[model samples]
Target chain A: MIEFLQYHLPVLLIAIPLIAAPLAVLLSNRYIVQSLALAVCWTTFGLAIWMVAIVNQSGPVSYELGGWAPPYGIEYRVDQLNSFVMMFVSGLGAMVLTYSPYSLKAEIPLSQHYLFYPMYLLCMTGLMGMCVTGDLFNVFVFLEISSLSTYALISLGRTRRAPLAAFQYLIMGTIGATFLLIGIGLLYQMTGTLNMADIAEQLEAQRLVNDGQWAGSRTMLVAFAFLTVGLCIKMAVFPLHTWLPNAYAYAPSVVTAFVAATATKVSVYAFIRVVFGIFTPQFAFELLPLDTALWSFSLVGIFLASIAAIFQQDVKRRLAYSSIAQIGYMLLGISMADVDGLSAGIVHMFNHALIKGGLFMVVGCFVLRLGSVQMDDWKGAGRTMPWTSFAWVLGGLGLIGVPVTCGFISKWLLLTSAIHNELYPVAILMLISSLLAVVYVWQIVEVLYFEEPSEKAKHATEVPPLMLLTTYTVVGANIVFGVWTTYSAGLATKAAKALLEGGSL
Target chain B: MFVSIFILTLLVVTAITIARIGDLWAAVMFTGIFSFLGACWMLILDAPDVAFTEAAVGAGVSTFLMLGTLALAGKTEKPTTSSSVVPLFVVAVTGAALIYGTLDMPHFGDPNSPVQTRIEPSFMEKSQSDMHGLPNVVTALLASYRGYDTLGETAVIFTAGIAVILILRRSNDGFKSNDVFNSQSNSRKGSQ
Candidate 1:
């Protein structure tokens, strides 16, 4: 039983949530459904942690579905990279599910609460599915599953603007999905194989035998262009991020927190997988010149998103823009394409998810107490909702890369990588972006701490116990991961090494 | 060749109808027609799996979703104000770039192309032996070698579904029995 669990855990991690989601819907009782969803998420999180441990103990685990072999049957390949991301995503998912009941009651109607847990479970399942799947077309199918579900989840916000935001996301998201499909189709048409490992092997053979560049094949180039643009839209990279702010702003707090934490991070992972896994570094750097393009775009994204973040009045909108800027930091690291740089990017992906998840949860708490997240409404919330306010500030500090926070660790690694590359200007730009984060975070801090308390807030109490507990859990994780860099940094380094070494899929 | 031409023509006609339709319902119907034509084209291209997915998702599910949205937002088309030359220029440039780039591509169905010569041979010859019992190479690939990407994609769909439900699910008792216009009249009387 133990051996079987160890071997087949990856599929179970996804199946648990996938099955639990619909089961929750069938149960239809609010409390029961929420508990069931929470249980499943927690179990999945535990399974992910164990899977990570097993991967560390062993190298990479490969499980063939229904006793099929690789390059023929669909394979679930688990390495240090995906296992680490799986842990972060599922861990945050469990925490967010714990926070949802209290948060949902304030924003969503009582009747809708029953639907909320199930949908969340399904979303988590989709994210996990995307992380674990090894096939190209399966990626598209799962992408649609996640995309369609997210469209529904975002539209469930109570605000009238929710529909419009969802519609915008829907349109943009569909285009992105379609572009991705076209890219995959072209690749399939060219290679006549949907298996990534097979494609990699064939490409390697072609590289060795033929002086001609398969990497520079027009079909491959078109696929690269389509995939990059599509993923950029999904990641909310600068100039393509218009749908994000409103979607985040108008979404119910729970939804915002979950999406903020996981959605774009998953997309970034997809980008990395395509750039590094499918197209080897030699091809990506030599044929596509991806590093140059990504570097320039990331630099522009850092500055532009920071400037935009500073101008937002709504707290959620500010965080949304700030997220785009932070994504720049991750992209900058990835653009370097070295082991250390990629490590920084992967580490930041984990750290940023924690920070954003905690921050959004704090915002949700404020919404519960004050009924809004406007800067003015947060006036003197520090004095009333002291724990929640402190969590927000600490989370803000993490976002700003203050010392002894998870954000600082990520920044330190990124800066070290940049300096190692002799890219002093990019390193300086990173510092500048941190300063901008400081400015935006301080704005919220000022409202919560320094500004006079509104008359309405005199009676404001701390959010419910569950909300406070969730906030503290993520905040504590931020601090712990920040102080002890052993696990997160190690996993990131291993994953980066795998990519840098150009491991065959 | 004739089938390809016929399917292409039908697709073009449906697309035009979708673009030109004045009524939202008509537009929705035309969109369905367009997708149906597209699915048929995919079928003619010898991609039954893709055609099935397109028919089920594009023509059926999406059409239903659009109509549901129209019911919520009202079925009237927002009045168009003026011609948009900027958009036209952008489209022209984009289209031209795409066409220019495609000119370098290997001809359709070229057996000697690098891609067809390299990977296709392995998949064609070895897939059955590689996977043992699995007959469909696509399914095998989807579930195995690239399963990680599929996992992520599934998460994306699940997230999108949750997001939609979270955003659009209406609050009970938020809406009154009367319409906004009626409520406004009642409020006016009360104020007077």
Candidate 2:
């Protein structure tokens, strides 16, 4: 029984949410939907915790679907990396679902509340699916699934702007999907195989011999370009991030919390997979000079997004731009292409999700109480919604990479990696960006605590108990993970080693 | 060579239809046609799996979704005029760049190309041993060796579905009182 559960655990993690998604939609009862969504999320979260324990003890585990063996059957492979990510994604999903009922009551219409739970489940399933799969084309297919659902989730906002935001995201997202598909098609044309490990093996075999023939082929180069651009768009990297602000701003608070927490992080994971898994670091770095390109683009993204974020009046939009800037830090770490660098990127992915998820949940609370999240609307909210406001302050400090926070650990590792590479300027740039983060986060902090509450806001009470509880849970995790990095950071390091060694070790 | 030319012309026609069709509904239908033609081209290139997905997702599912959206929004497109030169120039540049990129590419279906040389040998030789009993190499690769990516792609689909539901689902209480913008318009018509 123990072995059976261990082997089937990955599927159960995904299945719980996948099955519950449609069930939530079918049940249509508000209370039922909330309970079912929470149950599924918590169950998956528990499974993730168990899987982590199993993986820690046994190393990586690969389970083939329907008794089919690899390189033929669909395989779910869980290692240190994905297990850690699973914990974050599933844990966030559970907390957000817990918070949603209260937030939805104020922000979403009664008729739409039932749909929220199911959509949340689907989104969680997509993020988890992305973390666990080993196939290339399947990645594209799953990407589409998550993207299509995200567009719907974004549009569910009650604001008039929600439709327009959703439409814009749809357009950009479709373009990203098309680019990924074209890239996959080109790769298929070249390699005739969709298995990333198989492709890597073939490439390696070819490289062992003096095989310069296919090294710089147009088809391969084009494939690389498509994958990079598609991922960049999905990650909301600097130039391709136009769709993010509005979508995040107008999206319902729960949706914002979930997407901001998981979406771009998954995209970063995809980028790492393509760079290290499919192409191999040698080919990607030496043959294509991808590392250099990634470095420059990420640096630019950090500065530009930070500058852009400083001017925003709407709190959610401001955070959206800040999210873009945070993505730059992750990308910068990835571009370093060293062990510490990859570890930094991976750790930051987990850390940022916690900070952003907590922050957005707090925003949701504000929106619930005041019915708006504009800077002006939050005036004097500190005095009324004391716990919620305090959580936001801590989350904001984490976003600014304050000492003893998860964000600081990631930033410190990134800086260390940059200095190790003797990229002193890059290190300085990272610090500057953190300062920019401070500015934007401070802007919200000031509005929430320093400003006096207006007459309209005087009657605003604390958000419902569920929301406060959920926000506090993530916030607590953020601080706990920050102080105790043994598990999360260690998993990231192991995952980085696995990736850097090309799964051989 | 002749077949390539034929497919190219068909692609051009569909592209023009997508660009120029005035009715929003008609434009969506044309987009579906465009996807269908592309799938056929993929089939011709000997990629049945891709062709299957293209047909199902691009032609069938996407078209159904577009039609559903049209029903919710409206069938008729609001008339608006915009500068054409920007789009034309953008297309021209994109077309030129694509052509330039393809210039150094191995010719279509060249059996001796490095891609075929490097990959085909292993696929023909080792795939059986690698996957044990899987007959189809593509299926093997998609589900097994690279299954992690497939999981990600599945997640992408799930996310898209969630996003749609979240955006479209109504709140528990109901649509707001101010949701009756159309009511004001109806009253004006009544007054008229």
Judging by TM-score against the true structure, name the best candidate: 1
**TM-score to true structure, per model:** 0.89, 0.87
User: Considering chain A alone, what is the TM-score of candidate 1?
Assistant: 0.98
lDDT of candidates 1 onward, in order: 0.80, 0.79
For candidate 1, what is the lDDT? 0.80
- Proportion of true contacts reproduced by candidate 1: 0.32
Q: How well does chain A score by TM in each candidate? A: 0.98, 0.97
Cα RMSD of all models vs. native, in order, equals: 4.7, 4.7
Candidate number of the best lDDT:
1
Q: What are the per-residue Cα lDDT tens digits for candidate 2 across A99-158?
A: 787677666667776777777777777778777776677677667667777888887766
Chain A of candidate 2 compared with the true chain A, TM-score = 0.97
Candidate 2 TM-score to native: 0.87
Off by over 4 Å in 1: B39-43, B47-76, B82-86, B89-106, B111-192
Model 1 agreement with the true structure over A1-505: per-residue lDDT tens digits? 9988887898998889888876887799988998898899999999999999998898888877666565545677888888888899999999988888867776667887777777777778777877887777766666666666676777766555666788899899888888888788766655666667776776666566666556436657777778888889999988788899989987888999999999889889888888888878777777768887887788898888888888887888899999999998889889888888899999999999999999999988888777776777678888998999899888999999988999998899889989999989888987887899988999889988898897646779988888898889998889998999999887899999987785645
> Of all true interface contacts, what fraction is found in model 2?
0.42
Angstrom error at residue B126, model 2:
13
